[model samples]
Target: MPGLLALVGGDEFKPGNEEQDRLMVAAAGAGPAYVVPTAAARQGPDQAVAHATEWFAGLGLALRELPVLRRSDAMKASLADEAGRGGFFYLSGGDPGLVAQVLRDSPVWRAMFGAWRAGAVLAGSSAGSMALCSHTLVRATWPNRFRRRAMEALGAVPHTAVLPHYDTFGHKWVESAREAAPDLTLLGIDERSAAVWHDGRWRAAGPGAITVAKGAKMTRFESGAEVKGLRQPARMLPGR
Candidate 1:
């Protein structure tokens, strides 16, 4: 009944947490952890599998790749059975829009939610990480051209937008996020470092930091905060 969601920004998976990672590799009781790499590999599934394999190895867990992003009922049923039965679930970095469009309103997405509620460790990275909020900051590539809209996120964390590659990338994210969802908590996760979330508290680990941007008031925390005391601002884009 306990789950861990390790939402990574980007990093080479280095073996860590030997036992914990091993348990994750075993996928516990949730069958084999579902690896959803739909965001990437519109080109091919091998890329996604490569990424997942490396990530799991770094986490000290071994994973079997599902390698499919279909919204079919059979896939949904399989995912539901996995959640009801037992391991972990992971989403590799790629295109957030793709992930959303492919999995939106489908049984697979629904099953994921149920698994999370049942305490399934749902780890992800980059695009995968971005798609875990109620309001997500999709693409922030074109500086001033930054745009954002509401999509059906995983709804795991409400009133939040995950800003990955915070420190690694320049301050572009800061500007874009400020223009997009200025009032929400913009969790700027750095590379190598992760925001380990559980029991409503998020603690940063690894050799990096996390930035918490709430409107004009923004600050970075080496160790992230719990969901509580995380000031929720009004739902308005910046310059309101």
Candidate 2:
């Protein structure tokens, strides 16, 4: 079986979201859980690690931090070994563009994909989720003044882009994302919610809902709802 993939919206490591965390843990089987705080490194890894530690401790699981902060760290053989060993690997929230820029084509990223292909559960929250898609929405920096741009991502789930925090600020980017990549499926994931891939399709998990936007149509799938054929229309396009 392929490893379970969890793309969380945000607000992970909280009480109400324990069920989702537990699900990932259960999917991990016997290997240890590893938390990749690379995205949160700019904000401070210490705080991110601390948060993950507390959350995992609550579930009686030891949290191993993968310190792949910079591009240099992402290329280390030791970090790749640790990443490959994880039964469940999680990438926390932060700047999605930063995450992609640092980890793209890195040894650690290759190891992570290898581990996931080998049946290790993989989860990404907020920006982490964005980075996992084929095209990621980059929030504008101070100089850019709030512009959103679609950029290349990991392509773990190709032709898809995730808009985290959809219930709040994420909704604003929906139109821009559509205009940027009309053929791509844009998922608006609410906070504390997740879209998990299993049984050959993507299914909603957690408290909030998921919105699937393709061209001019937008469909909302509640928790536990099945999101099927999301890529069909795109595949039918002239140049897919």
Best by TM-score: 2
1-240 per-residue lDDT for model 2 (tens digits): 558888899988887677577777777845778888988989987888889889988898888888988999999999898887777788999878888888888878878877787788878999999988887898655554235778988767778899999988788888778777888888899999988885467888888888988888889988878976454211111122
Residue 197, candidate 2: C-alpha displacement in angstroms: 1.1
User: Which candidate should be chosen as best, given lDDT against the real structure?
Assistant: 2
After superposing candidate 1 on the true structure, give the runs of residues whose Cα lies further than 4 Å from its correct spot: 12-30, 54-60, 70-75, 83-86, 140-152, 223-240
State in Å the error of residue 147, model 1.
Answer: 5.6
Clashing residue pairs in candidate 2 are none
The sequence of per-residue lDDT tens digits that candidate 1 reaches over residues 1-240 is 446666666552444323223434544344556676766757566777876677666765567665446546325676656544435777777776677666655567666666665667776677777776656666545554345544556556667777776776724566666676656677777766666665455666656776777777777766434433242321222222
Q: Scored by CA lDDT, what does every candidate get?
A: 0.61, 0.81
Question: What are the per-model C-alpha RMSD values against the true structure?
Answer: 5.6, 3.8
The runs of at least 3 residues in candidate 2 whose Cα sits more than 4 Å from the true structure, single-residue gaps closed, are: 140-146, 231-240
TM-score of 2: 0.91
TM-score of each: 0.77, 0.91
